[model samples]
Target chain A: MSNRREIEREAEHVLRELSKHLEEIELEETYHVIDAESLRADSSPELRRGFREAALSIAPRRDGAHYVAEAGTWV
Target chain B: MSRQALGEAEENLARRFEEIERRDREINSFIELNPHAQEEARRAEKLGGRLAGMTVAVKSNINVRGLRATCASKTLENYVAPYDAVVVERLRREGAVILGMTNMDEFACGSSGESSYFGPTENPSAKGRIPGGSSSGSAAAVAAGFADAALGSDTGGSIRNPASHCGVVGVKPTYGLVPRHGLIDLAMSLDQIGPIARDVRTAALLLEVIAGSSREASMLDVEPQPYSQRLSADLSGIKVGFAKEYEEVTSPEILGVVKRALRRLEAQGAELVEVELPNLEKALPTYYLIVFVEFFSATRRYDGRRYGYRIEEVCGEEVLRRIMLGSYISQKEYAGRYYRRALQFRSLIRRELLQALEEVDVLAGPTTPKLPHRLGERLTPLEMYAYDLLTVPANLAGIPAGVVPAGRVNGIPVGLQVQAKPLQEQVMLNVMLAAEGRA
Candidate 1:
């Protein structure tokens, strides 16, 4: 895997090229943030049942209570 | 009386399943058959509702408990849904039997259905041409008579594109009109699950059942209207707007059919008005810039530990390309330049559509710029994105849009897209009903 520095460098290169392409289009609209409604999560029993069902269907690499993950290597 | 109706529906359901078994090898519309469909049909026979005994094929991206919700990607090829999507629950509650999971573009990314890991769906209307996608199978299932109707998500023309090619009716309901609680979203802001069926009434009926406020707070909170009840064949004094900008981009063959459709509406006593949509050229760019970013964000959940496989390693080329482009566009440095600008432009497109709808009851245009090409034909990603050019504006604007079989070009079906203001699905469907009558 690429290190942080390498990933940042690649990202910079991509932004440079992409920005140039976007610059060709002249935008007439001024910047303004459109207000989107905040999502309200339901904690009802039905929703809990749905979540439990989804967790059960997730591809198995999990313990009964928690998902198992690959151990990370540290430098 | 209900028992007799149930018996008839069971017969119809059995016949449809058998037909799917025989012809689906060639069509490839379905990914997995609901093993409990016959059992569900037997149960549906006892239920009473508008959709009682109807076979509804759901696109694989939408969750149906005990069925693989793959989104036609190898990444989730074995991932069975544990819960029904809000729309699926509503449909089942109303007595519709879930027939199977239909194929779609992997992660709902590609327009040409060929990006599906399950294989591209064949257009039943045109022998060798592509079933326009990413709702390719849902449209094909209805067109092929495998289902009475099917539900497909429309982010940017996923439902209408295939509906046009497969000669079926498809609706991309106003954004947020249908709850998205269980939809495997392509782009959260743009995705709305709608119905594809052989006729306008069935599409409208399914839309009525699936749309409106749900237990989840994701819907628009608008009081649902009886959309199917309001559909009318009458078009007297109804004003239909024909956008000149749509004409500039559409192919000559496709334009020929749409023009005939406009004339038919005129002959039916509907007044036609020429509307200017100056920002049509910019819509495609604006649509993709937002979708790419939103899609990228949505796919972050596909890490192998939780889902089937890590998306980056297993996704199709089109999906990978979107993720990369989205990642590039969403960089902190470039977010204002690309992503923010696209969002601002979205407002402009929405404003233009809202203004146009104030003048006309509905806006009519060709659903796709060109007819679908043959499967396996190589196209640049830009070419594939162009398939949604006409249909994306509605998604961008969060307006109600529907497609009806207008006419055919070279024996392949072409659709006339109709659009109305948000929450005005009745007007859009009435226009579609009139158009279907003309056909």
Candidate 2:
């Protein structure tokens, strides 16, 4: 666990060093925009049910109608 | 097909299954065996798809119905894929029988194949060494003859690095050239699912079968071409770029092997031009920034409710480190300085590679800077990230790049990487086909 802590700290140190070089690069917001055209195929209820069952079959805990998860701290 | 041919196909598959059962424990290449593989081989006789009787090993991160699509992490160790990935569906449509899922780095986070929860996958080429990863198991399985070909994803050097170490053929097709509908993304912008096989022609055939515009994914609009068709061994008219900067980061043994391969290409009448890709040094840090941020976003789905475990609790050191770094860089205060700058650097990298490609048909270099080391050998995260130095620029540029086994140094394999412009897999494959004969 201490090794994990060391690795995390090392990673943060490297990121800060990397950010220092960002001043050399020009500021640009022109990120590559992806084609948002949807090619999603509509699935039938049978397919939907199969996916639901597949997920539910392996859920750590589940009620009949829903997957049971640990209560959120925020909520 | 004749009955005799069908029988031969079945016999071949049976032998492969037997080999896996007998020797796979030592290599740890495969994670699961497709229960329906035998049935699929039988069905191949009646099918008319291009890959009618081929056996393909799929990376476990890509969904295969009825098999768990674990990213070699405990987080999804028991999560069964509800459906086939688009690539898998395409392969099945072409009548390729899926062998099973191969192992990988946890959440596709590591360069060496040692980070898997199932345990490290041993290199088939060098007995005690690691298999370069995150496509580690895919390359190993192909090298061990457990499958005719395998599918692997390259976010950076994942596919080609393993292919190089395993002494096999692997291609990382142009970003957005192959559909990523089912690939578990390490970095959404950089991830490309590609094919690995024993020979260039087989890899090209598998790529042909898998590459196209998908109904649910954005990909290149170009008509799929027969990449393996009429590939000429003669390199008379081809211009090959040799970047001098690659030698600075590459080990002497690997550089020797790659230089010799370049010489062979030169002998075949290829014009070797000295090219400069000055932005190459910046690719490593740039690649990591994008990957960490995107992977952090991708892994948010694994909150223990839908997957096998909460990633933060059960993931490996590499995965946890990336998540932490990603979370840090994504804060609004740091986003402009780190993530946005990385994107800008990525654009600069793309322009540099494209400009180089205009002068040459393809760029040639060592796939990885060094050979695989012994499993469990200690390497810092930056040292591990260095493995992708020679291979990441292609991913950043969104270009087609492939690895063909060039030669071996001291019983370990080195690969010659051939990179071409986006959607120019044909050029890449031809270079690979020529190198396959020489290598």
Candidate 3:
């Protein structure tokens, strides 16, 4: 099974590719972060860990689950 | 053109203003008609393109910055929004003037618009018939010609139901197509803002302007292929699938009209296929459980804290019913049994719709099974809730659906609902155009 990380990576990669097709389209912003603990808080730690693993596929982690990227990072 | 256009269109404003000013008295349509719409309509004439500076009425649940977003309930009766909802911001950014706010069921819990604190909005159809609620005023305003178009929130059957009863056109875009930021959500997973108008073209035009990705509504990250395009090809070979079980409980007059519509489509070159969905049996019970739990949870912020009046003190029957139901469903061990079952049922419905659309192009049915009910007849709550049976499945499926005036029965209008697969709005809309004689 391609885990959830693989899925997010694939989605972000396809979006970045699609943005190049048109001029003046609103590809000016793209923000993808997968933080299960801050968003859910009380859920299972394992589930949070799973989402943390998924985050690795989308963006490089800074500290813990927080990740940030500039708008229009889809290039 | 800009401000100069308002100067030019000044002559056209007097007549539209007088008509809205006259009819809104009886219908309870506008919470507040913008004092500036007439003044702005003059500027609108300078404006060009799709909307042409047309004015639009917004639902009370959506924000317009400093305007009140009471949601027709006492709890938020005094509330003023601090920011525009993404849709409202887009409308202004695109030059479609915001006319004013319209009334709705408190927290969008009712089917008859009777739960609004502003009082039950009179249906513009039969004097005694319900305008079919939650989006009641929004529908009544469009039918009475108060504005060119209005924005309404549909959770369950809110938008399509009223459109059916009031004899207008309304479209709920595919979920996440329109943004949710600053919408006082009735149910987060199901509520969507869409255009209600006199024709499908206007609905499509508004959808085109609003159907794009937004940063605030993170789920709305991908822009849809522009929704306004009308397929030039004939609908002759398109397949329409309908559940035969839908025929079991609907009224004869309403069913007769919907059947006639299907027959008309058949004569026009489209092929009709009979489809069966067995899981449909659990849709109703499941719908309430989810709505009740979510509604119950969403109201926690209204404890006389930030917004309007305290809920129980001023809320009407429908609002009270939901709060009470939400409390009961969320109590003790009943939480998972009631709420989770509903979510599971929602997933099942989504699966069935996706599976059915695999072979058929669209699903065809009466937007509502029953014609508008009499205004004062006493009925059980469940009887009223049953009106949503045909419509909620489409919302749960996260697909685009619309109701156009199919025909009249017993002097009230009936709607033909057409639904397409997730994100396949242009396809379904083409089919609706064919049924509405636009083809």
User: What is the per-residue lDDT of model 1 for residues B275-373, given as tens digits with 9 covering 90 to 100?
Assistant: 999879778878888887899999999989899799988877777777777877777635388888778788888999999989999999899999999
Residue B338's lDDT within candidate 3 is 51
Worst 10 residues of 3 chain B by lDDT: B4-13
| Model 2 lDDT per residue over A23-75, tens place | 66565577568887865556723346487788888999988958888756774
A1-75: candidate 1 lDDT, tens digit per residue: 334344445445544544454566677867568766764547633345466657756946766766666646897
What are the per-residue Cα lDDT tens digits for candidate 2 across B1-439? 3555645666778988999999999999998999999898888857746777788999989999999899898889898999899999999988788999999999899889999999999998989999999999999999999999999999998999999999999999998889999888898999999999999889988898788888898877756778777566788899999999998989999999999999999988899999999879888888888888899999899898878688999988999999989888787534377787888898989999999999999999999887888999999787888899989999999999999999999999899999999888888888888888677
TM-score for chain A, prediction 3: 0.27
Residue B310, candidate 1: Cα error in Å is: 0.7
True contacts kept of each: 0.06, 0.36, 0.00
Q: Which stretches of candidate 2 lie above 4 Å from their native place?
A: A20-75, B1-4, B332-335
Could you arrange the candidates by DockQ from highest to lowest?
Answer: 2, 1, 3
TM-score of each candidate structure, all chains considered together = 0.87, 0.89, 0.82
For model 1 the TM-score comes to 0.87
TM-score of chain B of 3: 0.94
